[model samples]
Target: MAEFIKIYPENPNDKEIHKVVEVLRKGGVIIYPSDTIYTLGCDITNYKAMERVAKIKKIKLEKNTFSIVCNDLSHLSDYTKPIETKTFKILKRSFPGPYTFVLPAVNNMPKAFKKRKTVGIRIPNNNITLEIIKQLGNPLVSTSIYDEDEVIEYTTDPELIYEKWERLVDVVVDGGYGGNIASTVVDLSETNPIVIREGKGSIEVL
Candidate 1:
């Protein structure tokens, strides 16, 4: 059975944060609330854990891509190449919200992202997720917790997720009902930002 943790979205308990970190450190996958939706995350550096999450989500490695959630811009350099000054300015104003930017992947990034030499990065404003990444000191390989048919799975109750994917995942963090909208995805690899998918964040800001 998966361990269920109830985290206060605004002020997560230290003990609960530690438990989530422990699961990630041990190569365990977790279902947690994000700024936009419920997501499945695993230590990006843990290849086995990443593969496990992919299997649980039924994501075909060839067709789907995953995003890496950094705690802040300081950690972005570790996974992706340096951004242009203009692009950096745009991200500065828009990030820490609900947006995912696709950038050229650094060589140090995991093979999963390196396979395409591009990575989607996010720096969410949520405290629970931010603290978890800060504690781990690395990005979490994450994707929306969508069903096999490509429907977003939004459940406020931890028991529901536990009932469905208990054996597949190691833990679930219940942070209340998520917004159920996805992050607005932007392709920053181009000279001009392209709105790939419209979600919670506004593309007009770009």
Candidate 2:
């Protein structure tokens, strides 16, 4: 079973945070809360851990693209191609909230995105998730934690998430209840940004 750690959503405990970071540094996969929902994440550089996440999701890594959660825009350009002036302005206003931007990928990012030339990047506003990434000193390759039950839709309760995913993952950090909705996906690949999925984020900025 995975370790269950309860972290304050607004003011996380550093000691508990350390444990989470340690697991991640050792290439452990975790389920943590994001602004939109509970998410599965692991060290972006750990290919083995990345593969484990892909397996848990039941998706082919080559055919699927997972979003990388960065601390801020500073870590973005390193993984993604240069954003255009107009797109940059739009992203500046919407990020650090509940939006994910899909941009052309840079060569340096991990090989999981090997078949695709673009990557989805997110700078979630949630403090617990942000602090974990900041302490880890690198971005996390992440995907929302969900099941296919039509009645359930998405898993938001941390205890239930732990119950369902504990055997498959290493740890579960409960940052209280998470939103059932997902972050609004805005793809910036074309000349104009496209709203691929409208969920929690507002559409005005795009």
Candidate 3:
């Protein structure tokens, strides 16, 4: 069974944050809240945990296009190639919100994503997730937890998310109710910025 933890969105508890980070450091997968929705995440460096997440999501690791949620832009260049002036400007304007910018990958990423040409990057506006990433000291491998129901696109309630994903993940973080919408996906890998999916993040800056 997964460890169901309640973390306040406004002010996250350090003790609770430590618990989640410990789980992640130990190669455990977690269902945590993001700015837009409930997300499945693990430490990007943990290949075994990445494999577990891929299995739960029914995606092959080699063909995965999973996003990495960074705490800030400090280590952006470490995972991606040099950001062009225009692209950097856009990122500076839209980050710390619900936006996933697809950028060209660096020659050396984590082993699990070594062959990936591009990677999605996110710096969500949620405090709990940010604190968790801060404590973990690295970006998280993230993907939204989508619902199969005809009407609802993404799961909102944390308890329901926990119930559905308990057996599959090691931890389920209850950061209150999540949003039904996802992040706005922008492909900045090319010269012209392309809006792949329009969701919670506003397109005004893009």
Candidate 4:
């Protein structure tokens, strides 16, 4: 069963945060809260952990493209190619929020992201998530927690998520409530930014 760890929405506990990081380091998959919704995440460097996440989701991305959440813009160039001056300015203005920017991937990212030559980078505003990434010292490949039934759609409640995904995931970081929506995905790989999906995030910055 997954470990349900309740965390403060504004200030996550350091001890509990370290425990979450340790799980990821040991190749464990976890369901955690994000800026827009509850998300399932794992160590980006752990291929086996990522495979488990794919199985839990019961879906295979055609290009094997996964969204990786980072702590800040400083690590962007490590996974993706250098951004244009204009693109950097735009991202600087909009990131650390609910925006996912799809940019060209660096030649040496994880296999799943590198082959596609693109990566979806997120710098979520959620504190619990950012602390996890910071302590883990790497990015997390994450996706929204949802089910096949369109009636309920995304899972918003942490207790319910614990009940449903306990066997599938390792941990559930309950950081209060979530929005049952996803972040706005903006593909900045081209000359102009493109909106792939508009969810909880506003498009005013784009």
* Candidate lDDT (C-alpha), each: 0.84, 0.89, 0.92, 0.87
Q: Candidate 2 — which pairs collide?
A: none
Tens digit of lDDT per residue, candidate 4, span 37-68?
89988999998888888777776643555698
Residue range 1-206, candidate 2, lDDT tens digits: 89999999779999999999999999999999988988999999888898899898888877767999998888877788887889998888987989998899888667787777888889998999889998999999889876678887788889988989889999999999988999999999889889999989999988
RMSD vs true structure, all candidates: 2.0, 1.1, 0.8, 1.4
Error of 1 at 66 (Å): 1.0
Which candidate has the top score in TM-score?
3
Q: Residue by residue across 1-206, what tens digits does model 1's lDDT show?
A: 89989999889999999999999999999998888888888988888898887787677654458898988898778877888998898889988999999988888666666567788989887899999998887789888765443464465456676788788888888887777678999999889998999999998878
Clashes in candidate 1: how many?
0
Count of residue pairs whose backbone atoms collide, per candidate: 0, 0, 0, 0
Candidate 4 structure lDDT:
0.87
Candidate 1 regions exceeding 4 Å error are 60-64, 148-153
Predicted structure 1, TM vs. truth: 0.92
Worst 10 residues of 3 by lDDT: 57-66
Model 4 stretches astray by more than 4 angstroms = 60-63
Which pairs, if any, clash in model 1?
none
> TM-scores for all candidates?
0.92, 0.97, 0.98, 0.95
